[model samples]
Target: MILTRRAMLIGATTTLAGCDRIGSNARFREALFSAENFHKWAQRSLMTRDAMAREFRPDQISPIFRANGTANPNTPEYKALWRGDFADWRLRVDGLVTRPLSLSLAQLHSLPHREQITRHDCVEGWSAIGQWRGVPLKTILDGAGLRSQARYIVFHCADRMGTGRPYYESIDLTDAFHPQTLLAFALNDRPLSVANGAPLRLRVERQLGYKQAKYLMRIEAVQHLSGIGAGKGGYWEDHANYDWYAGI
Candidate 1:
């Protein structure tokens, strides 16, 4: 019998609840991780690459968008940028591009941007709606001149996990160029707060909130995920066995 995406997500929820016990069994952990590949394949096969997530009107935006993950990165490097109001901050776009870019906050703001109100669904089973404004990731990719071989875009963020490793996430070029995918600099028409990924954050609307990497320091286009953390494509996925393909 075939399971729908909804069914799979429900199953994932149950699986996650027992994950601590599952992690204790090495064989069980390996089996679950192996199944993640099939899960990714099934999701991509069932949904079109460009299938849009539902968008809402401004009136639908949530009054208090709850901050997730790192509310405030206490690292010295991140603190310096926050202190200077990110004037010296630069978002480096490199790897598998003909023209690598190092865009400043001012330059990013000057670029063409798209604004939309969309729902953010978290793996923790919560949701919120917010207005996000930023350059469509495609615009940046185009400027960087993506090479034909480029397959995925990896977001390297400033926040570190408890283990002190930098946070990161990856999405395929299909999602990278999707209409709703953005490098958001503003939330609710205001400069992003430090608690909510100041400077810039990723908004891949079709995926879960964990995939929405925040406080981006670099964007790299690569053909493979092998060199990334644990070769699973994300920090949480590497450390906590979160599904690498976190589409909801």
Candidate 2:
């Protein structure tokens, strides 16, 4: 039987609840991590490296794309940028790159862009199809000139979680260079609203919604995930035990 994305997410959620009840069980945690690794391996092995995520026609786009996670970061720094219409905001690209970059919003807009109407499957079991327009992430990576040691792309965002941790996420180079992966600045033919990650957000189409880090302030290339927040890759992955490889 084929399991839909929603079904898979629901099953994962149920399993996570069970794991929470057994939180102190080291063996159980190890088993869960092993299972997640296996799932990622199976998906990658079964599909071509550049396999494209399903995209929809413009008419199929959702009438209302509900914003996930924080609507607005509301930090003084973010608010200052918002007030200036993000003209002063810059996306820093460094860490394991031959040449670091500090790209302004206008500079990003000047780059070649791609637009796709794709479905966003959220772990919370809600999905929305929206048209996203932005520079392909590969374009940015190529410009930055990755050092040979770089294996992952880390997104640093402006939003702070309830625990006062900055929101962040990572993806392997495979996803980073995927044709559909983008540093999206516009959604549905308009500049992204603050609630929808204005100025910049990531569109790793093949992954779950949480992997699409929003309010992006920097992109860092790293050799290992160990030095990141709590060493689990992302805020949710570290604090809430969400699987790091949340591939759909």
Model 2 agreement with the true structure over 51-163: per-residue lDDT tens digits: 99999998899999999898899999999999999999999999999999999999999999999999999999999999999999999899999999999999999999899
Lowest summed lDDT window (length 10), candidate 2? 24-33
Task: Give the residue spans of candidate 2 off by over 4 A.
Answer: 1-23
Q: What is the C-alpha lDDT of each candidate?
A: 0.92, 0.94
Task: Count clashing residue pairs in model 1.
Answer: 0
* lDDT string, candidate 1, 1-248, tens digits: 99999999999998997877777798987886777688778888998988888989988999999999998888999999999999989999999999999999999999999999999999999999999999999999999999999999999999998898999999998899999999999999999999889989999998899999999999999999989888889998888878878874
The clash count of every prediction, one per candidate, is: 0, 0
Number of the top TM-score candidate? 2
Q: Look at candidate 1 and tell me the lDDT of residue 68.
A: 92
What shift in Å separates residue 69 of candidate 1 from its native position after superposition? 0.7
Q: Runs in model 1 with CA error above 4 Å?
A: 1-27
Clashing pairs in 2: none
